[model samples]
Target: MFQGRLVQGYDFVDGDTDPSEVGAPYVNPAYGHGTHVSGIIALVAPEARIMPIRVLDENGEGDFWRIAEAIVWAANHGADVVNISFGYPQQTQLLRDLLDACSDGTTTTGKTFPEIGINRLFFSIAAGNSGDSTFIYPAADADDSNGSLAIGASTRFDRLAQFSTFHNRVKLVAPGENIVSAIPGDRYAFWSGTSMAAPIVSAVAALVKARYPNLNPVEIAERVEQTSVRISYGNPQIRINRVDALCAVTLIPPATCNP
Candidate 1:
């Protein structure tokens, strides 16, 4: 379930590995964040194909360049939706340029939409785990910059994670805490953080795209955001509903009666 392996770039400042040979298999022993996130996405979009692009390594770390390259690769390949659950603490020019390229349909690998179709390439990123109101890199990055979706994590109760970053850049929140999903080597586990929450929304985006391929990424993102089921906290426990997602995809219209 892992994102495959780190192919190049990431190296610990203390390690002896060369940047040229940074790619590493994402097997167990190391924390399997990608595995859990990938499973959540697969669960929501059972019909969609997943491209396991490795950007992180065994140390639970990676190179900004490698991540940027992975984004470009996903766009160039036949990836209908690209889910990036990881991000760096600081923004680099190269990273920003890469994200911009992905959103604007320009990249080293190739353009996403022109080669595919308008709005065909969708970029969904985690809002980051930092507990702050300020926006974080990549997620806070302008939408038109690459026409992407920036997602924050919420509890199963639909309350924003105290640690989840809140900003104008945050479009929506989804289940992230204690989310259950697959691990490396045919295992499963539960993990917390916005990292896990992003894919749920991403998978929903994919479902909408798959069912209605004519809709562009911007259209789909707008639909999901505008249709989110907002539940208030402090009084009672709030939560997200599958029906909310169904409604976002327009499968179930608002105010519909249940049999």
Candidate 2:
């Protein structure tokens, strides 16, 4: 069993510090979104520890500044991979700056978090469900050149989901339609959205990290993208790729798989 704690940071939403309280009635009243995300990660890498920071409330909404603070806290508290499944339509300078700083291995204000060097933290964010080319904060900030990955939704048939937001910022797509995962009250449910897709990427990241602990965030992302299956969709033939867990963990170089 994985030994870890769920960190609670939502002042507007009530939660418990006790890890057992996770997914309990009042702790995750928003239909178990955070719990579901955490469950996906655990399934992917059972050996890795999960740190759930409650930045969003039951409604899947939270203050941007509070979200920024959670990022800082995660970095400071030994977070190797942070999975953010929520997004905003518009990018705010404050949120962008915070993410940029976090990517550079510092706090939102340029100060470095102790023990965590520059660019050590990696973030996997959702591209949102706008079904357009609109950009979403944090996800839009994903720089593959850095350690961040912006994920879109892919159907079981290897096609992009109708509701998934797409743009140049998105690095890859994953299975997000009718995904069965854990929910509150010890139940499981099938959910869809770019939010669901983001955690799948996060789980793969954890596997990559576990296999190659020396690799930085950028290297891990490169491994993921390089090992994915290329797929094309849309009228103009837009090209994207889907994550292949075997290729990522085997450390096979890019182009080794059939396209």
Please tell me which predicted candidate would have the highest lDDT against the true structure: 2
Q: Pick out the ten consecutive residues of candidate 1 with the lowest summed lDDT.
A: 5-14
Candidate 2 Cα misplacement greater than 4 A, ranges? 1-29, 106-119
CA lDDT scores, all candidates in order: 0.65, 0.77
User: Taking the tens digit of each residue's C-alpha lDDT, what string does model 2 give over 129-173?
Assistant: 999999888799887675788999999988999999998889799
Best-fitting candidate, measured by TM-score?
Answer: 2
Worst 10 residues of 2 by lDDT: 5-14
Q: Which stretches of candidate 1 lie over 4 Å from their true place?
A: 1-30, 104-120, 142-145, 233-243, 251-259
TM-score of each: 0.75, 0.86
lDDT of 1: 0.65
* RMSD, one per candidate, in order: 6.6, 3.6
